[model samples]
Target: MKKIVVIALLIVITGYVFAAGKSEAGAGGAVEIKFAHYLAESHPAHDAALAFAKAVNERTDGIVTVTIFPNSMLGNSQELVEQTTNGALDLVIPTEPAIAKYVKKFNMVGAPFAFKDYAATDKLFAGDFIKWVTPDLEDVGLKYLARWEYGFRNYTTSVHQINTPADMQGLKIRTPPDFVNSATVKALGGVSQTIAFTELPMALKQGVVDGQENPIATILTNKMYETQKYLSMVNYTYNSTHLLMNIDKFKSLSAKQQKIILEEAEKAGLAMQKAVREKEADQIKELEAQGMEVAYPDTKPFITAAAPVYEELKAQVGEADFDYYMDLLGKSRR
Candidate 1:
């Protein structure tokens, strides 16, 4: 699918979406930051990004502003990240595994079963963990603003119960291009295919893949229920994401502008997160109403199947860093 660059589109949306004041964008006028992400408007992630935009505009008195494009309206996650690194797009929030392609060690952050829940994720984010991961991104030309939760990832399918690795034998499963996710499917004996988001709906309807795995919010927001049946709350991975900006462009910004931007982004992320946690049951109920069967498979079996994923991550990020992550996680549970 073609990328949806929101910077140009943001201009078009000014009169319609932003109302009267937005046409002032220019070389030295109000700086319009184009933010790109891959979540539908209805999803909490989009809600947070949009909230950040509104907050930035409000907090900065429009001198420093943000315009958000959700659901890859500014292109897919990869394209957005490239744009951000090139300073063409101001920001992009990418799933850590996708960002892993650029920042190798970051792949460890979202390995299958990485964090138990939001609390664990919050603790990791609040500490020095991300600082340790930042050095890896400097060489890649992108600045890691902060680590954000991608929410808890669950497994879903159109067929049988996936309580054990054997149950998934030979099933055609669609997964994101993350190595850990791909490996998990392979470990469980499924024929894993890395499919792009825009093409997933068609792929499902055409039976190109028997099932896919994603958070409840993603599955529902993407309307996968129309194409799939079984929803397994595997909680296999709490796929965290990173908000990134161009290294040079971020360095060029005034300290005040940078402060306002990141602080507002954090505010937006927190709001979005709280909303998702609150709406979890609602999303689950909607899926059931749509005739999709939802089940919380005994998670131990799924966790057991995911054991090797961590070791693989360790191999990528190094044992020291992997051990440090687990150590922090262990502390967080207490």
Candidate 2:
């Protein structure tokens, strides 16, 4: 009788332990998310991303973990987008122009003189503008999380300084893979050469191109100053990068997890933007200290030269939407 009672108690304890183990497994399993970007680790955006991943992990109680692959370790912008679309990548951040190739609505952001300054551009993006165009991304299997800044695109060269459109005449300028960028270079009377970002330094060093255009932060972070002798504070174009996720992968997350990710991304993006704003002047000064000549030329001529691109892209974005964007800019300027 004593032996039978002991055996029964042992069986009951064993069953309870098994049930607890199953419950723990159901609650403690982690969801891993892979995020990729093409910026170096020193970039503000990269730092912000790591912070965001940490926030998400903590907020979700370690149920969601984000692993970031920076400096194009995953692939270039185009390949990253493709991978995200196919569900191989969970998240990706690509510049507006790169994404503009898939959704033309983004092209409006890259138009010359799109906004008076970074503040105005930031306002427009932080407002209803992004919501209006986000629907277009769904068709491409992407879900827009937030708009992050890539800073203002400036001109740099090993040959001569650019003060006006004529200054760029016959200059071979390396541009990103964007039609608007190429158009802007052409409008400035320079020949546009599209080169891979990874190969830009070699292109500039080898004299394959006389100059290139990118944000101040990008030029500094990439150490293009070593290859390029001059920096022009053209502020010719505003480069906006968008944080995105695979729609299916996002939808697969629990409602709570999705909310945390979106909220965290926005927080991270705003922090990164602030850091860029703070560092822009400092970075330019650092470039000068590094032996690159800096110039602030009259931008009126470049702005006037770039006017045609707006007209050309207006037809593509439709007159109504184009007008809407202008109206937004007008409000922001005031």
lDDT of 1 by residue, 227-253 (tens): 888887877777766778778766766
Highest TM-score: which candidate?
2
- Return the number of clashes found in candidate 1: 4
Compared with the true structure, the alpha-carbon lDDT of candidate 2 equals 0.86
lDDT of 2 at 163: 79
Residues 1-334, candidate 2: write the lDDT tens digits.
9999999999999999876654432344668899999988988879989999999999987878899999989888888888998899999999888887678778888888676677788678667777777888998899999877798889998988887889899999999788788999998899999998878889988999999998888899999988899888878888878899999988877777888889999999889899999998899899999999999998888888888998888887789888887776676666
Segments of candidate 2 deviating more than 4 angstroms: 1-28
Candidate 1 ranges beyond 4 A from true positions = 1-27
